[model samples]
Target: MMNILKRVITVLLCLILIAVAVVYFYMKQPQFGALPEGVRLERIKKSPHYRDGKFRNLEEKPTIAEGYSLVGELWESLTKDYPRTAPKDSLPSVKTNLKTIPADRNVIVWFGHSSFFLQLDGVKILVDPVFSGKASPLPWGVKAYKGSDIYTAEDMPEIDYMLLSHDHYDHLDYETVKALQPKVKYVICGLGAGSHYQKWGYTGRQIIEKDWGDKQEVKPGFTIYTESTHHDGGRGFTSSQALWLSFFIQSPSMNIYYSGDGGYSTRFKKISEKYPSIDWAIMECGQYNKAWQSVHELPEEVAQATTELKAKNMLPVHHSKFTLAKHSWDEPLERISALSQSKNYRLATPMIGEVIRLDDPAQTFKQWWKAVK
Candidate 1:
């Protein structure tokens, strides 16, 4: 009996070791990316927010909401009754020829989720571009909704600047970055985020990493300021080693604000007080749940943030692409649309690949999602 028990224990230990070895090698792939090292780490260490070996938010807050266990929430999300998390059919889109669009016209195109294209003052900018279809390091993770991936790197023209808000896989896709590297003249991102680009074979000169409160003039007429956001960043098991950010873009003719991703806080109100004339505010309005309110904003909070920013027009994003939350895919759009109408806020709801003239606040889009089953 003693000899039989010893054999069973030895086999169990061997199986656990084999599993660990397999996971280690799998994570070593380029998709997992490298952490900030050498100069990148030196720069990250200098930021005031960096302390105790990690970046800190403006205020102390829990990543998961109070009284919620991450394990339990994830179990519920995987097994509970989730309704309309994805569209019943392929979503409608208009494949506009980006290269043929007139250079003088300032316009913005939504490619769904946090990715978008902006042409301001004749300079082309792409933000948080994740055209790889999947939003995770693993191929089977979070995938883009059907028909939401109409635009690809092949469709893009020469990009003047590429803006990366954070290091999260959804916001900073590895495959998409490699594809766009040739056309991208300069890459702007939060502190330490350029490490992923460096690991992916981009020259150090082509990347510009900045801390919050830093400003840079990217072109003769375009300037970008790094702003605070109440969020964390990581691609693997680690978290908050690098900075996450929002952006305040100032051009000769317009000022645009991009809220990368964050929960409700006084920071938005402070930003509005500083820059009272934001022409268009691109706000994150999806993938929110009570379990993770510390990072992502609820739909109602998005509307309130728009009002706080004093933006002339609001373009809701971070939805209609991947099902990162338990809420219905259309909930973000439906709720924000209703709130905008009641509050008399100007809203822009362009379809995927459809363009909206940035200067024209009254430009309207069809309620396309309402017809989708």
Candidate 2:
């Protein structure tokens, strides 16, 4: 019995060692990215949002609500069956040649799941572009929905600025950004995010790293303001190692706000007070659940946040592209659309790759998700 026990212990130890080796080597892969260091680390440490070796939300609450655990969520995902979590048929899309777009046109094109392109007053901006068809570090998982990935790196035009909200795999895809480097001029990311850009071969001059309160004039008449959001950011083994930010963009004629993957908070009230006239608010209205409600907002919360922002228009995003959460692919739109009745802000629901004319008040989009399974 003693000899049998010893043999079993030896086998278990060997298996443990193998698991450790696999994890260590897998994390060493380039996609996991380098951590903040040297000057960047110094800057991150000094941030008001950074303390106790990690970046935090302004509200200072748990990322996942107390009742939820990763293990529980994982088990539920594996055991439960949720229909249309991803579309069964190819989603409809309207492709436009980005380069051929009129130079004077003021428009926005959403590529799905927090990725989009904006052209305002002759200046072009791309936000959280993940065209790699997968939001995970692993090649096979978190795949993009069918017909959702109609755009690619090669489809992009000359980019004036690439706005990276954070370092999450979905928002900051490695392969997509690497392929888009040539066309991109400058990258605006939160503090510590440039470390990943640097590792990916982006030059120091090309990266504009900013704290939450910092502002930059990317062009003579266009400025981007970094602001606080209630979301954590990390790419690999790390958690909240850098800031996740929402952006307030000001052009001579337009003011836009993008709440990058954040939960509902009083920050929206404060932001609205600062910028009295946010003409358009691009809000994340998907991938939400009570378990993680502390991080991602539900559709009802999205409406409330937009109301607090005093936004004239709200474009719901972060859904209809991937199944990051167990809810049906169209549940967000379904809920938000139903809840938006009598709301002060106009709901903008443009289809994937469809142009949203920034100045056109009569622009209308059909209930596109209703036609899909």
Candidate 3:
């Protein structure tokens, strides 16, 4: 009995050591250029991890219990208990000819999820682009819906700037980034995310890392500032070891906010206070459940959160592209539109690849999902 117990302990220690070594190797910071002049490392005052009026060093969270069940249930439905009815209509298709933007004001096009293709003052920018067929660490893990080929990285026009929110597999695809690296002039990322890109061989013009509220003017008319999000950032093991953020783009003609996957918080009100009457807010509206309340905002909360931002117009994303949640795929749109109608918020109906003229924020999105399912 004594020999067996000692062997078990040895095996456990070996397993622990192996995990530590792998994490250290994968999570090492990359050699990159100096962060921009205004950028600095800092912590949020009122974050959940704060205590005694000081920021607590975030401990490594082994796993998130809250969202674990949601992911498990979603997996079961996809594998074992899929609906008897056929899957909904595949995502909308974009025209073959990728639309060109005139050297003029700002135009935003949704590539599904939080990814958006923007041309402001003739500078092309792609935000949170993930062109891979899946949003998982492995290509075979979680597949995206079929038939929604609005644009691929190969189809993309020369991208002047690539803005990333974090290093999650979904947002920062290794294959997509490697393919587009040559054409991309500049890459911007939240603090610590540059480490991931560095591992993936992003040596040329390393990403511009910024803390929340840190602003950088990419050019004359296009400026990007990091904003707050109630979410943790890290690909695996460590929690908040890296920074997660939203981008606030200020152009000559428009000011827009991209809420990259976050739970509801007073930060929206703070952002609204900072930039009142934001022209358009690209917000998350899907892949949410109450189990993960602190990580993602539900459809109803999305409406309330937008009201807090005081946005003039809003576009719903993070849905219709990937099946990341167990809820009926189209449920987010159905619920959010109802909530938006109740709140009287101006919502834009932007099909994948459809150009949303920033100046004319009056278009209503068709109930595309209703017909889809």
Candidate 4:
């Protein structure tokens, strides 16, 4: 009996060693492949998956809300949000069918979460393109509110610029970047995340790193300015080692402010001081909790953020897409609508694929999430 038990243990040890060797080789092989120029392997102290900062409490463990588990939230959201979801028949979601981006018109397509398709002065731009169903390093984690891949690299129009708020997976998707490198003219990101791009085959010319208070000219009429955001960045093993930022996009006829993902701060006031009349403010309005309230503002705070920026129109995003926090899936949008009306701000709340013309009157779609619950 002792001899038989010894044999079983010995085989188990051999199997474990083989599994380790297999995973190690798989990870190392990708490193040696021919990558783009200026792209090289280097270690960074952080990743772009989560918010990290000096005040960020890395040790805090998130407790799933009592009434809202991840699976239960999904169940509630689908019945409530999707069945009542208005079909965007007027807008063509395909990149191949994308109409001529009007030369002087500014169009913003809110792709749920922090992603947007902005066309200003005939220049097409995409922000924080995370089309994956789940925003996790592991496949089995919190899934996107809707199904994934509404559009992919192959479906994207001739992308002139890609603006990234920070390195968070919800913002900066590695697979998307790898596929978009060849087609993208310029990639603008906050400082320190350039290394991740370089590793994935993006060139320095293709990658532009900006710090707060810094601005870059994409063309004569289009300018991107990096401004401070309170969020932190790190992928997995590291924390707070990468820079995070919000951006002010100034085009010929429109000045747009993207809040990225940051808690409510006095930064909006500072931004308004710099650019007094912002035409549109695309701000985060969901995935918030009191514990991390400093990093993600609630819907009310989102309204205040827009007001501080002196924005004429407010588009509440970062909600109606992913379950990043413990709140009811649609609470963020519903609250922000009430807040916007009370605050007297023009809230341009469009559906996921609906287009908001800069010249058109501001409008709000029906509350579709009511159907799910």
Encode model 1's per-residue lDDT on 299-338: one tens digit a residue.
8899999998988888999999999999999999999998
Task: Score candidate 1 by TM-score against the native.
Answer: 0.98
In candidate 3 the C-alpha lDDT for residue 204 amounts to 36
User: Compared with the true structure, what per-residue lDDT tens digits does model 3 show for residues 1-373?
Assistant: 9999999999999999999997676545331112211223333333454345332223332233454675775676668754412235776655533445566756788887777788877778888888877787643677777665456788778888899876666677777887788778778876656656666677737567666778988778778888777776656654454567788888777888889887777788889899886878889888776767666788878898889988888888887777776677777777877788866568876677777778765555667656665
Model 2 has an lDDT value of 0.91
* Clash counts for the predictions, in order: 0, 0, 1, 9
Selected candidate, larger TM-score, 2 vs 3 = 2
Best by lDDT: 2
- Tens-digit per-residue lDDT, 218-326, candidate 4: 7898888988877777664455545687889998888999988888777788899999979889998888876567678888889888888889888888876666766
lDDT, candidate 2, 1-373, per-residue tens = 9999999999999999999999899999888888999999998998988889998777788776898898998899889998878888888999988999998999999998899999998999999999989989986789999999999999999999999888898899999888988898999999999989899889988889989989999778789999988889887778888789899999998999999988788999999999999999999999999989988999989999999999999999999888899899999999999988879999999889999999999988899988888
Error of 4 at 30 (Å): 7.0
Regions of model 3 farther than 4 Å from truth: 1-86, 96-99
Positional deviation of 279 in candidate 2, in angstroms?
Answer: 0.7
Tell me model 4's lDDT, rounded to 2 decimals.
0.71
CA shift of 273, model 2, Å = 0.4
Q: List the candidate 4 regions with Cα displacement exceeding 4 Å.
A: 1-96, 147-149, 362-364
Measured with C-alpha atoms, the lDDT of residue 181 in candidate 4 is 81
